[model samples]
Target: MEVVAVGGCWCDFVSISPKLPKKGQTILGSKFLTQHGGKAANVAVTVSHLKGKSAIIGRVGNDFWGENRIKSLNELGVNTNCLQKTSGHHTGIAMVNLSEAGENQIVGIPGANYQVSAQDIDKYKSIIEKAEVVVVTLEIPVPSAIRSLELSQRISILNAAPAPENCDPALFTLPTVFVVNETEASIFTGLPVVSFEDCKKAVKCFLEKGCKSVIITMGEKGAVFGSDATSDPIHVKCPQVACIDSTAAGDAFVGVLAYLMTYRKDIEMEQMVEAACYCASYSVTIQGSQASLPTLTTLQQYFLEKF
Candidate 1:
């Protein structure tokens, strides 16, 4: 298949309002919704929309959220042969609050996500070995992530979000494509990423730590990619759009990037990068995470018209 995404799944309950509340304070929310979201699942859905054969490998609690997650992934056209149902435990749950300014605060219970172990990863070895690209995130335990990284035969793209202060050193040895946001970059490099120069240093540190390429996404300020271009970081401007929920913008970008690299044979790197940048931009124009991801037709009609 073209791309395979492996990680945990979460059922997110979100409340949107003017702002979050202070400690011990309860604030009224203007709107509320529940949706299926998980880093890997969101990426898989985005990949399917991009016309890639995306597969998912992970476990879900045999609860309602778990049932919904499987149905949602299937509806999105992601291959679910590798999705397993656990007998005990609950599907991961996230409580998210959004402000009118498009800012978010989230708390994840991480139920079944935490239960994904090395053995579960081993069960999907053949699936990982057959894809052109494998995209993973930190939603699951590090051992599972490591196992996937070890078994994957294709390009491995890791989005180390909810950045852990430390990880097994073996992860540094994988042929990984590192994707992190500004805060994650700072955490990884121990330096503030206030400028493009700071981002370059962070990317350098990541590469030296064993990544094949480093892409640092900087919200509305755009993103910086470092690899072969020594003259300057390949900077991409974020498209101007009205702000909305930005919860899964980064996932959308990474998913689109992997899909394009694997399936868009005629496109150049710069073109693919631009497409990903635009995808992230479009995601911010809407609300929710997976709901915000743009379809290929939507991308062509709205975001890529000027290109």
Candidate 2:
């Protein structure tokens, strides 16, 4: 049986710089590349690369970037049936600056991403109902994301990235798994997510807000997973790898986690976290967005070498 995954978010065009510029200061960049990105698109491609059936539901402009993004997704074995194109809007874009240390800063132009409405979710209600896991990101309109979450019949995984300034508390309760980085965790909980205890506190706060399970990703420190079903949290250490570009690391983590939830449901949580950690670690060793994601063969080889 083929497990189906559906994602709703933006498709972005990204540019990379060697280092971010200071106030009114200009600097030379090392490289320039274009790839298909956006949290939803990245997750959908990751699912397909991991041998699961995946589809992306979102809007892009009827321009060169939009056309290329759809074609790229199709080539990667992702179903583009729900990727719509708008005539007037431009495709979403992100200007990403990376330091030699693999740190990054991104400025996004929402463009057509913000145009994704609740009506779009309604049009794809059947897809959501049929999918084994539905992925929602904060990059798109909140209403559309909320509607998609509401429509999910099975598991719904929410990757709350670039956390909204004033997110509705009710939105946090809809996902079976709520994933966030330290910064987003801090934003949502209004507490400093600096230590493991801080992450534990943040997890408790999210659980109190109705989240069934909470995952706080602490980058090099590994990740912490807490749930209502278990009293203690599971901490999975990330693999050590030389960092190249940390652009899509989090997206890769979310993608693999969702893929496991959809297809490898019988696996232990520790195993799932290990796989996700490996995938994310591998992603940072490469540069670019979707280009950084590891395919099943690459991931398996990594495990064989590491374990």
Candidate 3:
């Protein structure tokens, strides 16, 4: 069976600042670059780089940013047949401030991303049905994400990012794999994910909510995984690396993990987490969003040399 994955989310134009400005104060930014981003877009590009068949199902503006985003995705070998361009809206934009330590703060404006509708998902029903895995994010309209989950057959991976207030609880029950970072886990479980025990508690909460598996990514500390099929939490430590820009690190983790689960189903959970960590670790060493994703060859060389 061919392993095909689809991503449904937003596409954004990103700007980076050297350091975040304090309230009512301005600071000189060190770098300015436009990149193809948005959590779903980043994941799609990462999957393509990892040698997987990938497609994006989302909306973009009919403006230049939207055109450039589609062009970039095509250049990266991701299928953009399902990506739509809307006339009334502009492509989403994100302003990212990167501290000297590689930590980041971002504010996103959901322009065309908010245009993704359940009808759009219905139009792409065949694409969703044939995909081995469908990746979704909260960047788009919640209804669209719900529709994608409703249409998917096998595995639906939900990357619950930019945690929304008052999110529909039913959406939590649909994904086969639930991926969230520490803050998102905290939001969903109403528990602070400050320790391993807290993460375990959050994992169990998701399982009780009917998720088949859950993974909580804690930067530098690594990630923890729990599944209804397993009895204990699995912790995979991340490899140490110098951080440059952490913009796409989480996207790398989600993308690589999804690729491994779809293409290498026989691999154990530990190996999956390790590969994801490796990919994320490499991403932070570089700059930009999609540009930071390592190709399969790069990953192979990295593991051979570093591991």
Point to the candidate with the largest lDDT: 1
Off by over 4 Å in 3: 1-18, 301-307
lDDT of 3 by residue, 193-249 (tens): 978888989999989888888999988888999999999888888889899889889
TM-score, cand. 2 vs. native = 0.94
Worst 10-residue lDDT window for candidate 3 reads 1-10
Q: How displaced is residue 21 in candidate 1, in Å?
A: 2.7
Tens-digit lDDT track of model 1 for 217-306: 988877888764454567777678787888888889889888887877687665666778888888988898888987887557633475
Candidate 3 accuracy as lDDT:
0.81
Residue range 144-242, candidate 2, lDDT tens digits: 888988998888888887699899875788888899999999998899998898999998899889999989988877899999998877788888889
Give the runs in model 1 whose Cα sits over 4 Å from its true position: 228-231, 301-307
Collision pairs in model 2: none
What is the TM-score (0 to 1) of candidate 3? Answer: 0.93
Best first by lDDT, ranked: 1, 2, 3
Candidate 2 displacement at residue 247 in angstroms: 0.3
Poorly placed runs, candidate 2 (over 4 Å): 1-18, 302-307
> Each model's number of backbone clashes?
0, 0, 0
Worst 10 residues of 1 by lDDT: 298-307
For candidate 1, list the clashing residue pairs, or say none: none
